[model samples]
Target: MIDAIRDYWNHRIHDLEMTDQPVGTKRFFEDLDEYRFDKLHYLPRLVDFSGFRGQRLLEVGCGIGTDLVRFAKGGARVTGVDLSQTAIDLARKNFELNGVNAEELVAGNGEALPYADASFDVVYGHGVIQYTADAPRLIQELHRVLKPGGTGLFMVYNRVSWLNALSKVMQVALEHEDAPVLTKYSIGEFRQLLAPFAETSIVPERFPVKSRLHKGWKGVAFNTMFVGTFNALPRAWVRPLGWHLMAMCRK
Candidate 1:
């Protein structure tokens, strides 16, 4: 099971080569910071890496090390793990290319982390656990590695989103296939997975992002019709329809 996903991501890394960032010409880290701000709005929330000076921070499933580089540049003692060696290697290159220092980048499973229990001040993962064979078990590992009261922030796809409906109608049910594990989490299900943590809360994130299914004006038009207008709707109205659900936990 693990090998299947690892191979999938390895092929993915080769095809995409790097994590997507906002296009601009700046110092590497500067570009990344702007990219994160525009996409994640992460200065004071969702793992709060900006406040992580001198703390031990672990990013499980740290793909290509984009966020790990940001945290390291902010002075966190950063460590990252990814199930794909292709991702791990690219992440190492990203850190070195930007002249940021991370404590380690290991290719490892989140379900059985290599570190000792209660060893980290912060554990973070984004768009990660849903793809693991056992999402609940990975949550246990997240709890295990955190110091008492340590923070864990994770994001997974929301099962009730427009994307979920569209994918089922246009991609899965239309083709007579089961939805993959990545599409498995409803808000209640994700909250239940995080229940064992000391204090856990879930919030919706990134209502529905623009799609890359096609390029140019056609893509823009599809996005405007299917997502853009709805994405701009105020959170109070769209909270329940959000495409990504963020879980914040303390262990």
Candidate 2:
């Protein structure tokens, strides 16, 4: 199962379809960065990309090192690991193109990471826990690698989210839905997975945004009708319907 997941990602880097820029070039990385932040507009508001200055950080499943580069530029000593060597290779080029240095970047499995216990000040695994073969094992490895009182930032799809329902209703598949492993968790289920943490807070985020991928009438309706109506509703009323569950955990 792990090998299958690795093989799948080895061919498909996240959001690779969004760009025509030459792969491994500066513009290619820039395009990906723009697309990511635009879609995940809540990311910077929630996670302090520049707040980890002078700290050691590890990003597991850091695809092409997009977020990792931001952490490095903000003065965090960053190391990245991915099961896909293709991503690691491109990540090296990404850091080089951006003129930022990373502590290291290697191709490795997240469930059994290659680092000492308590080795990092921050461990980040966004959009990765769900795709791994063993989510609990990967979570435990992330916890094991963090120093006492260190932070762990993670994200997984919300099983009981508006997007899930919309996908079913509209008969559209979520990105990577056909992967070897893709699990979604409810709020309570996600909290249970973070049991090793001393303290944790989960925020349901990734609300409706205008689509750049979906097309035809479905896209038009979602962009014209759904986005406005959803955002117009009182946030408190629709809070739990968010598509992504963002968790901030302390060891």
Instruction: Summarize candidate 2's per-residue lDDT along 1-251 as a digit string, tens digits.
Output: 99999999999889988999989888899999999999999999889999999999999999999999999999999999999999999999999999999999999999998899999999999999999999999999999999999999999999999999999999999999999999999999999999999999999999999999999999999999999999999999999999999999999
| Candidate 2: pairs in clash | none
- Deviating ranges (above 4 Å) for candidate 2: none
Q: For model 1, what is the alpha-carbon lDDT of residue 186?
A: 87
lDDT of 2 at 87: 96
Error of 1 at 57 (Å): 0.9
Candidate 1 has its poorest 10 consecutive residues by lDDT at 172-181
lDDT of 1 by residue, 1-251 (tens): 87777777765642141235532223543555555556566424666667779989999989778789879988999999999898898788788878889899999999999899999999998877877778888889988999998888888878887657776665423111222345458888888889879788888776555644346765676577866677667768878766678888888
Off by over 4 Å in 1: 14-37, 41-45, 169-183, 215-220
Q: After aligning candidate 1 to the native by TM-score, how far in Å is the CA of 166 from where it should be?
A: 3.1
